[model samples]
Target chain A: MPDAGSRTASIGLEGGRAVTARPTAGAPRSVRATAARIAGDWLPAVPLLILAVLLLVLPTAVVVLQSFRGETGGITLANWAETLSRKSDRRAIATSLELGALVGTISLLIGAPLAWAISRALPAARTAWLSLLNVGANFGGIGLAFAYTAVLGTYGMVTLALQRLGLPFTPPPSTSFTGLAMAYFYTNIPLFILLTLPAMHTVRDDWMEAAEVCSATRFQFWRHVGIPILTPFLLAGWVLIFTWTVGIYGLAYALAGSAPAAPVRLMTLQIGIALNQSANGQQRAAVMAAILLIIATVSLVTYRIILRRATRWFS
Target chain B: MVFVGRLGRGALFAALAIYLLLPLSAVLLSSFATTWTANPLPDGYTLASWGEALANPRLQAAVARTFGLAAAVLVLDILLVVPAVYWQRVRNPRIRVVTELCAAIPFVLPFIVIAFGILKLTGFAIPSLLGTPPLLLLGHAAIAFPFLYWSVDGAMAAANVVKLNEAAQMCGATPLQTLRHIIVPNIGPGLATGGMLVFATSFGEFALVQVLVGARFENVSLYSLDLLTRTSADFGTLAVLTVLTFIVLFVISTGVVWSNRGKRGTAVAGARAMTAEKDA
Candidate 1:
């Protein structure tokens, strides 16, 4: 919580009054004051700010600028045109969105119930389980992709077990667009669980008890009370997952190799591969535009919706 | 009566346990299977494959490089994140928004954007990122920043930071002294948790290292990837590494979470005791 006095002090100091008030014309008061302020705040960020801007900001600006230009220094929409011209490119974008949506939905389905169970479970076990869930959720991408490949690969034990049970196990064709989506969903379960856990905790037990005392059916309670309160949070979590998967290149690259792995392939994997080719600069630019456009739309829409709902908390 | 509840709970735990453990078990089994090339199940169990992997210098180098990068990023994340978050807590809405926008840049933007941005700016003018420890650290830090920032911010939000700072200030402590003596000690658990997450991320990261750092410096994940792709697969080494990583991450996460819970418990107890004292 903001301290009342600190708030007052910070507020009072605004417009140069709080910081440097001519220092009574004393020797080194201005310098000491400035040094004190800098030491208090800016010192910690100096190295990080320098590194982040150099390592992150500069390259991003260059890519965006380069994407809008031709090799001959002409600005053109030709790259955008080229990216859209290909059926494969369109399909790639479609697959990525589909994967993100499916993963978000399924993970939510699995995660929400699990989160509820954990919240109600014994405290120590709950803590232990949540920690495990955290690790699992964060453990995916490249490392987990390979682990899945080993488990579900052509000679994977799951397939072996299914075969022994007289069930036809076709090894689930690991190289297709569909397979990649399935892998993403499988790995994403823990992530959704972890993200949604915080929201579940925020729903205090007393609120649930109140609903239960009123004889609210599980579905009715969830619908009328839980859903309204938790909807913004769920949406926020979903959007976060979607944004993450949209930019995910590791799983796409590792699992599907060089194949056009659908929508994700177009935006991330294909972009990387396209960049490697000398003649596909325009195509790469077009793909980048499309990817950025998708990200901007999703993020902006989610931000607006969440921001509106978020104001209720402030009020 | 408790028997039924215990049994029911046990069954529930078993199901969840199986779901989580099965994949890991499968991987570990394959890691030791000698004839993975010939049979669906490992034809023979042996440590030979693991020995070979460990013997290779590349794997060792990569593991070293990965840890080194993780350490660097931990420092960087704290340095950038603390001030930015503190200012976010202190500044006007507009300044807060701008700083938050800066902090959130990595989350919204993909890795390629970040990587490409870095590369284009520093292309050959400075040394290449290829095999450079700092460059690898930067890539990992970019990915790890959002996690560190969010977790630390959550902890800061929960703590009564301004009150503590003001109390210290009233006690005649300088700003630096207050932050060092009061703030840092209280927020220790958060910093530790964030650091652990950053460590785990960099240690396990495969993509950035492979793309930017390459095989020149191999972390365990990259090494595992290479082993998987080898014509003669080495499951034993992969097994050992997986088990070790799982154990290390489990310990770090549990430790951080436990410490945070302990601090929270103390805070609650202290508050309650103070209330009681006032009543008396």
Candidate 2:
């Protein structure tokens, strides 16, 4: 019930109506005091502010400026023009969206259930299951791609085993679009679990008890209580995963045979291709990065909004 | 809800375990294979790939370099985030918003874009930094920002570092002494957890190093990539390298879990902070 913001609400007590009675003494207010407080807040954080500006702001600025810089040493929109006009670039953007949606849907289906299962387990099992999921989530990048190929590729162990059993279905090679989807799914299911598990704990058994006392069937309780409580958290999780799909590089980069010829032309891989194209390529890469940045920012903000709504619902 | 009761849940967990364990164990299996093709398991197991992995100069350099880079990034993150986060929590609470925003840049930019930005700047503005270890080091530190920030913030809030500092100072202890004897001891688990994640992150990082320096300053991830891409490259070597890297990460993660042992899953502050971070 006691959250950070409410707990600190009494600190300044501007109108002298404090939110809490903690026997706290309020500092006398004056113009000098206000100035000193502002100074206190900003001054100690200067080094951090500088680092934030230098590391995050400066490089991002470079990306934005370079996006507009011309190859002939003059400002030009030719790069942007080509980028927008190109079919491959547009397809890459489409691919990113489709991939995000596909992976998000599948991961949610698997991970949400797994999270519920883990949440119901004994504490020891719960901890161990989470640790395994953590391992799975972190087992990524070149290693993940390479490992997936060995397990699910044309001559992969699983593929070969399925062949021996004369199964009707054969999974695609890890380099193929379907295989890449599977690989992304492998990482994402765990990620979804990790992100949504905490929100699950917020569901109380007492609420379900109250529902049963109201003569509600188990299914009815889930429909009115469980799903509604978890929908926002699940949507937020989906959005988070979707955001990563657009920007993810390492996994796709490893799987990309060559940037331009990659089986899947994710926005990130497209940016990689653009960066390697020379002066014009670098410019194109910048423009793409900026576009991707905007999409990522918007998706992340949506995630935050959904999460805020979820928390408010909980309260 | 009865449709998926205890029995159904057990089946679901079993499936999850297989999905998680299959590929990784396959990698391990391949690493020890003398020759394996078109089979459920390796035809023969040998230490040949492990030997080859150890013998290669590039692999050795890559492994050593990855550790070095991870170490540097972890140190840099602690230096930049710990004191700053502590100060914000204890002295300037309002600055929390800015710190949080800055920390979440990694989530918004996607690492590839971050790599691109860094690559572009170093090419023109800071030519000396281009293709240098320092640039990659800085890149890793920047990307590893949110992990350290959230960890320290949670630890500070949990320990109520402010109240501790106030209590100590009121009792006439110097600021440095309070930090030395009280703050560090209390936030140790948070720092350790965050440090582990940062180390794991930098160690596994591929895109930035691959784009910026490529084979020039090859770390383990780049080395694994090199084996995958090159003609006449050995999958065995790649598998061996990957397994080794996974083991290191596994140990670090175990350390993370171990440090939070008594607190139960609910109070695994850093682990949960990492989840919220990815939410960003």
lDDT leader: 2
In candidate 1, position A2 carries an lDDT of 17
| Candidate 1 structure quality by residue, lDDT tens digits, A135-195 | 5654455556656766777667777667767878776555676677667765577666665
Q: lDDT of each prediction vs. the true structure? A: 0.61, 0.76
Clashing pairs in 2: none
Q: Provide chain B TM-scores across all predictions.
A: 0.75, 0.89
lDDT of 1 by residue, B71-127 (tens): 888887887777665544443223343343455566667775565555555554475
Clashes of each: 14, 0
Give per-residue CA lDDT, model 2, range A161-271, as digits (tens).
Answer: 988898855767555678778888888888888778877766678988999999999889889988888888788888878887667777787777453456667788877
- TM-score for each of the candidates: 0.81, 0.90
As a whole number from 0 to 100, the lDDT of residue B53 in candidate 2 is 83
- The two-chain DockQ for each candidate, comma-separated, is 0.28, 0.43
lDDT of 2 at A12: 24
> Worst 10-residue stretch by lDDT in candidate 1 chain B?
B268-277
